[model samples]
Target: MTKKVCLILAVVLMSQASRACDDNKEEELAIQQSDEYFARAYGFTPETWNTLYHKPSSSLQDALDVSPYEGRTLFKRPQSSNNSFKKYFNRDQEDHENHGRFAFAGLGANIVNTGLFNNRYTPANTWRPLITLAKRIPISVNPNFNNPLGSFDPCNSNGGESGICTSGSVCSLFGGRPSGPCDQGQVCCINVINSCGSIVTLNNTYWQTPPTALRSPCTLTVRMDPKFIEQKNNPICQIRLDFVSFTTSQPTAGTCTDTFQVGGVSNEVPTICGDNRGQHMYLHVPLSSNNPTDVQLLFNFASGTTISRSWNIKIAMLPCGATYLAPIDCLQYFTSTRGRVSSFNWQDVAGARQLNNQNYNICFRTELISSQKATRMCMSVCSATDGDAFSITTPPAVLLVASANTGFASAVTTDAMEAAQNSAVGATYTDQSRANGITVATCLYDYLLIPGGRDANNVEADRYCGNKLNPSPGSVKFQNVCTNLFQQRVFISGTDTNVQVCTPIRPFKLTYQTDGQETAVDAVPATNTIQALADVSNTGFCLEFQEN
Candidate 1:
């Protein structure tokens, strides 16, 4: 019985092995078929190969264990190499690209008829240019479109109508007339929006223009708050009364203030008013008042024609009480020699202040028509020589400890002034401390007088101590160098003239000897050449005698 059983077991094992061999052959054929199908469709084998089979082993890994099932590994597919697989795929891609290039070249050559064409077969073309660019780019985009001004939403939705709203309007989805509007003489309009998030319209014009006669200047009252003045340098406000072309002076009772004479010749003229030439006028008012005040405006014109207009202005107060005060005395320098105030304005908010508390915040303006020259008076000072150079220098005070108890003694005037006014006002008070000398005149050149004598004919060149030479050809030319000394004591003798330095005196004063002279006029130093003296007046100097 045991022998019979062993024979049967051998036969069964042999049959099972044969069946396993047949199954392995079938799986190999299936893998080959799959590979053939993938190559025909996509030009490369499929990425993964899988088959389902039954195994007597308890786990899939046990069935796949190559150590136990050596020969049964079966139906081996070719393993792929990095280069070989890449080259195989790349060849198909190259073939597709070549097909496209061939088609493009065939079409282009047919159209243009140039020879040896790969693409774009024009006579001058060598190779096709490859195009490269992004179809879309990243950018910053503002997509909000609710407000026309492109600002925050113009809506106010507070519980109270007047609380957050500029005027007495509510932000209602059902837009209609607002209830409880502002009082009479005021209009409600929306000026700002609040957090509650609704549309708000407020009422009220900040200020209104009053009616006045044409061609005449009228004073308008303004209501200003003291808080406003605290915030501005000059608490003053400017306004425009009207535009006038001409004006005349009002006649004085007796001799109309005889035209302010030079040699006692009654030279008075009538004051006229009004012009249609369309010039602008300005008036200034102080806006520091807590209450409103009436502004008094004086109107004068050249012609009888009248003009009426209004001006608008904005006002704000400076941060500190210490405001920038313009030196009124310095303004005198800018006045025209012809004797009229030119139209100039200042908008430095840091320096404005209330005029007298009487003038309100109303815009101040006047008709600025160009006026004719005013007659000037001649004051004669006999035999007053004119060669002294005016000089000014400041030095930083040295600190000294006189007593152990006290800090530095109260600073001197120059020290105090410089400490108060630094470069904030653009004044070089500190730099003046390091300078050495005061002004001493080298040669006489009169800035106050008109051109005179032979010296006026001198040809000015870059001289060391003398003024920057201005080229004067005819009578203003200099035959020889007045003085070739190089020093810091040069004088500005005339408004349009320059400095002249020398050792020995010319035949006469450069004004009289070089330029030409009259009995009354001579060259005098008007300003310090070392300091900033560009803005000096020619008004106060006198003329002793007149010559033709």
Candidate 2:
């Protein structure tokens, strides 16, 4: 052949060889892509694929590189004799069920290659073998299982139009509505009545004036209302008095022009007259048959130019048999009905008016209902009396002062009772001193509360007497017994027809115990009285007093 003919023949042979090589490469690429799809879809490694294909043992890398579908390609004609397709389908079903029922449905379509690209064998569209992979396989087994909006059905569970009830909106559970806004330790009732855990207040008001007579005294009466008596089923209940206002023109001692007396008929004796102008008065008076009346304010203004006097009173009723856990201060009951009275002037016998600085005189009485003992009594005189002209002329009463070794009935004179008398006279009386007096009286009088008489042969009489007359240091019962002297004089003055001397008493603090295991210190009004009752069974309930 010539050079030109040889060049043309070489180009044609090279072109034919190149075409054959390209077709072989395309076929290999197709086989690789098909192997990869089956490995992933059927959850098999190269080793497992070899075993399923009945191929000889080989290295992992060699088996992966050599496609199982190279000789038996996916594009080849189907064979009924080879049941390997069924095995792949079975394995796919097992994997689908293991992961979840819906996880491998799309995987099944890819492996079977039934629909798209069943006849396509071109290498340009390699992804055509996995067309169903892009068709969207569900991430979860149940399509509606994880839809956030579809998970909760609030309307069905809560009797409402929406899943969550609106604020302040009513909701029903088990066919019942919720109720609230109840008080502490209380529950709201369906009947809509606020009857549980309530505190009730009962109050009444009255006004009175004293008469102008010398022997006959004026009176202000207080009794339980008919309605209250009917409800409580008793004549007497717990009560306190408020001396809202007391105004007297001339409250002087000698002139008897403006004298006043105050006490419970059965529980307390009448107090000596002192200047009570603008002075608040509080009295805890229990009205029983013995003291059938609550209180009496006797006035004797026989000499002053202005004999006018008037008073306003308010009474508070508490529940009967109610236990008071806190200390009750009777003096606090004295509301600011009027201002304080600082001074007054009394006309002398020579007709010359004398300026006398006025001071307060208050009295108090307490009865121990259970102990049946002599009442635990306390008295205080605020502004000192002008003792320069006043004197107790009556013979001193005799009292049995007992000692550990020998008990003697001696005459305890009010004349020598200078502590309370001088304290009141000098206007130097203090709340501390008054408290000391109460402590002594309660201790001493408690000893005198014998069953039969004031004799030494009584049971434990010596011990009781010794404890009262002689007390240890810093003890409540160690104070002087001057309160008894003051009480004697007040009693004498109240009953004495020849003299009408009124001693001045002031408000003082008192310590008392309540039923609830608490010790309370409160100021008791000089005009009021105190009463304590011992428990009958000698239980811890003993030593409780009624608060005014």
Candidate 3:
């Protein structure tokens, strides 16, 4: 082929241009049917004609020697890619994410017999095979669906319309009309399912304060506004309380005896609401008041049948220095009003306080919700004495001392007690001092709970010895005695098996069975049975079984 024709062919092959943003390169080509480049050069580019005619073996040297346009063949095309077509196709993942690479020369040339024929070909004819291969096979490409004219996703205060793509189950924009927003009073709820299988319900709604449950009248008074009685029947507005009981696999004693005190001197009685029920229900306080004019509701959950209910109206606090004789016990009850007492003032014993002139209202709450149910006996509220005002003395401060010997020993003692309680055969508790670097001090006060007396005993045992066992005074006949001390009440038995002897724990009264099998006192029998022993000094004593 002539040099001019070779140059023209090279220019035409290089005319192909890649489109903007389009990786596939293809451009129109000028096919010269009568041009010397095609007519004289075997109707093909110089290299193609040379390769077809000579069929070179090695470095194209033999073809160059035989070719008339050897020197012009030196014009190079863009570097052909080394990666195979299959390799490029393999890069695609199932998720449609990939960076593919392709080689056209090897596969394209082999398919169409590219170098075997010499023809007057245009750029399209030269690259037609490669284009066909690419078009025939599908490409996994991501398509953009975003709309530039408007916001694609609609959202409401409620979490319903949240994600970009909607499942139709969720509210979303479909036709032309927009989806409505969330309603008032109710805030949006975020549905978050966490890894631990907990569904967290998040809401914008909030309350000024959390509601409190009233187990007793005292609890109701302490937690609620004294005037909260007005909201008695309001369903959503009313405070709700409940009681529940169930029989377990075995007839087990409850954690608490369900007993509470009334006046300072009276023995604590089992709450009525707890009768035949394992759990007790009472009042719920949604609001509370600070003014003295308000009257708080007192509900006694007596035996499941009888509920001793009353109203204790509070009197305003008086000036701190005000003088007056005590309100007499003879005038305790009020003459008029809804079976309510007239004007009455609670004394210091009823946890009363003298109002300070600077403070307009006196505020106090029940220590425990259960305390609100029972009425507290008050001291005489008397008018000021002519000469001097009476002053009640306060109890001294209690100081807890901690030393190396006591601190270390207390922990050891607690663990030992826990271990003994957990054993099949209760552990024999001896007050022997164990030395592990230091002597530990275990307060006997908490180890055992005394149920018989009015005062709760919290005395620590003498450091020298463990604890001494004392019996209940009520168990004895005739003779009157003050078994108010810790020794005379409840005592820690062998281990976890705590036994109430003569004076059985109030709410958990012993069902004495005369039948030999169900007797209160029994020897080591077979399975599923327990026994107790009673004495004048100590009632409800237990013999803990020892493991073999």
Candidate 4:
């Protein structure tokens, strides 16, 4: 190749650029992102092709000794990439994302016969034959542009659906329509076989509750095909399941009548039953595994079921070290800084009863990456106190506030006790703790662990468990409705009536804990919270959270 042809070849290679976006995420992961990442590789730039032609080495050197500097071979590096392709792929993952890396020699003298850039456009062809000597292949790799498997590789997003990133000719071969543009003259394909049993290999897929009632044991297994280890370069590190619309039979006491289990993961996801709509969970993928493990979403309905089930769950796959990845130990993760978190099956999910034996952390994002800053979080019972919306008291469904005398760690059932029985305070009293401010420790069986929680007086009341938001003679029912002017109101019949809003500045974290036993207690116990009721079936709390 002559010097003039080299200039023309460099222009052609530069012109080969595809449309790309600067942002990796536009909104929630459900929204199909048009992010096209392009990375300029450091290998075989035009100046590095000088001395490799005359002397093809008996053993390959780190990089082609084209010149001392100016340009360097990409396969090896002056920046210490060693000889392993694994480090190169990890360092520049965006290069092999929706867009594959650009590998070319621009113009080379006798480089074709030396067997590196044999063809004008397919330089990686010669590199393919050399990898077979290894006993085991890498988990993921850069799909050579000329490889036939690239034709069916279901990668990238297209028109709000998971798409196979492939060339136009190859897309047509599989009867897939070219929905959108991908990098490197390829198209995002939208017509692949997607069903419950079929292994989903793409990102951003949707799995809804089966329309038919008979479709029990419905499983949608999301796993990267381990067979094509050479083509998949980006490993999905985390899988976020957005319960866009999830509903099923409520749990019986604490046990699930119908079950939705997450399987094939190394970690154990707690089996949950009942209404989980508007909720999300993060399932992590172990990166060190030679073959990427599968994460299965299984929904098994009880035989001869009566409740109508409907769900629309969106599966979003995130690459390793993605921004949206939740903490490794977190089972349920929320990216939105502000939202309401109702306990499983609260508010009519079994007649508004709290699921028993519950223990899990409800995590919220406090990062400054979003449009809103989660600097401080203010939580109150969901503004819905009309009926039994915010009723997770230890004693069945009622709270008794002493109009006269109330002390810390004392029974708060009052209103003459007869009037409390006549009123809708139920036939029993709830978990009572005049355990005010930071000394709030009367609650043990079921309570929200809010670190640095404070009362309206701005005192450190870091824990809350009794009847209302703070210590108040507020659970008194007036005209058959529990109304507390001293606390924040639910839409009951309601707004915060407190003179001052309590502590809202703490590390945003809350753990909802419910003990295994729900047996009724005749009197308040010195340990494990207080409960005085004929039936101790307490309703779970409904909390509303805000980030800004």
Q: Write the per-residue lDDT of candidate 2 for residues 1-548, one digit (tens) a residue.
A: 59976775576455445444354454344334334432342233333222212243244455356432221111221222232123223445643343212223543342223222211122343454344553553222121111111111111112211111111111121111323322122111111111111111112223334233223345443443312211122233434443445555532222234555555532232232323333334344453433244444445555536444565444433322212100123222211111111112211122112112212222122212343322222211122232122111111122334443443333243333322121111101122322353321122111211111112222121111111111111111122244433322121111111111111112212211112211122334683433221111010001111212
Per-residue lDDT of model 3, residues 161-207, tens digit only: 22111222111111112233322211122211111111110111111
Least accurate 10 contiguous residues by lDDT in model 2: 535-544
Best by TM-score: 4
Give the worst 10-residue stretch by lDDT in candidate 3.
356-365
Ranking by TM-score: 4, 2, 1, 3
TM-score of each: 0.19, 0.24, 0.16, 0.56
Please state every model's RMSD to the true fold in angstroms: 39.4, 40.7, 37.1, 15.1
The lDDT for every candidate, in the order shown, is 0.22, 0.27, 0.20, 0.46
Model 3: how far residue 65 lies from native, Å = 99
Give the winner by lDDT. Answer: 4
C-alpha lDDT of candidate 3 relative to the true structure: 0.20
Off-target runs (Cα >4 Å) in candidate 4 are 1-196, 211-213, 225-231, 266-268, 347-350, 369-375, 385-389, 396-442, 471-507, 521-539
Q: Who is ahead in TM-score, 1 or 4?
A: 4
